[model samples]
Target: MDSQKKFWRSLWQLRVPNKIKHFMWKACNDALPTKENLHRRHVMDSTTCDLCREHLEDTIHALWLCKDISCVWSSLEWFHQAILVQPANFRELLARFRPCQDEYKVEIFVIAAWCVWNRRNALHFNRVVSLVTSICREAVFRASNVAGVGVIFRDNRGDPIGAMSMPVPFGQSMVEMEALACQRAVQFALEIGLTRVVVIEAFLNGSGQLASFENILGDIRFQAACFQHVEFNYISCACNSVADALAKKASSALVLQEWLEDLPDDIAPLVFREVH
Candidate 1:
């Protein structure tokens, strides 16, 4: 236990943010005030796990030992290895990661742990439970800041041309943003006199949005008709990382900004990866 304490104390030395370190330290010390702890202190009568409702809540159970948490861990590619080396508690879990040289993996674990805790709180207090995939994706999104939209422009021979991304405006749906991004790309193509061009977007397939689906599609089609050759292609978000990064960049924009050569240092690596 003393050795574990040393391990927990060493976590502050990591390059992670102080907020995360504080949360992790609290988790290590069993200081999160889980339902079981609160109930023991007469704060509440029930000690049920808000997510599963089948067991008493504790820091370990709420963060890691629940069935819902198991599902979340199993959803990740690293789950097999993680489970093989599973620890007895959240502190031990974090301790295992402390010696890992890979900062990115450590970041993912930290973010995922935080996500699980947040989801547990939401369910307990607000009666809200998000899907497991959404929770994991949220962790990845927050850890990687990979929530933006990125667009890569290509020439007729499918050669690399240009790429741009802007953050999605607050309160805008992804589908709405997809349509808007494609529209903007088409308008730009027309402006630059590129008569033939293709707009590839992630997650736009004319499903849902019954009322104005066609109207949106019709608008895109109308815009494409103005060009001599235009095509709309749907690709998985994984294949659209650069464009996604750009959209994330745009989400923080007060006004639309164009980047021809001076891509921001943060997103330059993603742009380079896409181009290469």
Candidate 2:
């Protein structure tokens, strides 16, 4: 009981956007109006999932446990690992990501879960079911965009270890830029001997002709193998302001700039906001 209380307090204090925090709180409470809840309220005659009618559409079945959701979560490396533990509820499922020790992981997980829920609603009302890949990818994009500005490095207790800011070289496509940032982050992690990492990026949605996403993905995979474990997540440009600023610096920089155990005056506040 004490641990659960601590978990809730920690969750509320996380630096995620308030909407995401609200969604997670509601999700844990079974208050998102899933079909099962609707049925209980006499608002829905059937409790079947709108996407796959094989089972009742409870919060778990809609976002985490449905057969249709299997493909979506299976495509994500983190969730794939979490399934082995078979969390009995959403909070347990989220706790699986604590090993990453990053609030960003929570952001990604919540965004993905919300995406699944949003898609289910669309199917229920619009009678349209888009590709699950598209939905998941969209979630990744949004998660990245919301985290405005700067690449932040932190310890388990959320203390800053280091930070890097570099601009994408001129004329590089967004895909190329994202791929480059991820590569550099991986290299930095390798240098620091950090075994577990999650690389977040925001690539233009299906944009850029210079390089195929498959090729970029191949490169990311190769670098990821150098770590004990690694994950790549996508977010929107809006969420990536700090990294974007760093990339801008790189663009104008005559050479690479590195900050160790300290941050520039301008970027320090962003880090402070994220932690406190």
Candidate 1 has what TM-score?
A: 0.56
For candidate 2, the lDDT comes to 0.67
After TM-score superposition, what is the CA distance of residue 58 in candidate 2 from its true location, in Å? 0.8
Cα misplacement distance, residue 258 of candidate 1 (Å): 21
Any runs in candidate 1 off by more than 4 Å, and if so which? 1-6, 127-130, 144-276
lDDT for each residue of candidate 1 in 1-276, tens digit (9 for 90 to 100): 998566866777655578887888888888888998899899989999877889988888887778877866776667446668658887777766666655256666777787788777776678656566556545544554434445667655544466666554422344555676776777666766678787887546646753454566677778788888777789865677667667756644524666654566786777567667
The list of candidate 2 runs beyond 4 A from truth reads: 127-130, 144-276
All candidates' lDDT scores? 0.68, 0.67
lDDT of 1: 0.68
**Cα RMSDs, all models:** 8.4, 14.7
Tens digits of per-residue lDDT for model 2, 34-112: 8889889999898877677788878878889998878778766877888886788777887776557543556667778
Model 2 TM-score relative to the real fold: 0.52
TM-scores of all predicted structures: 0.56, 0.52
Give the candidate number with the greatest TM-score.
1
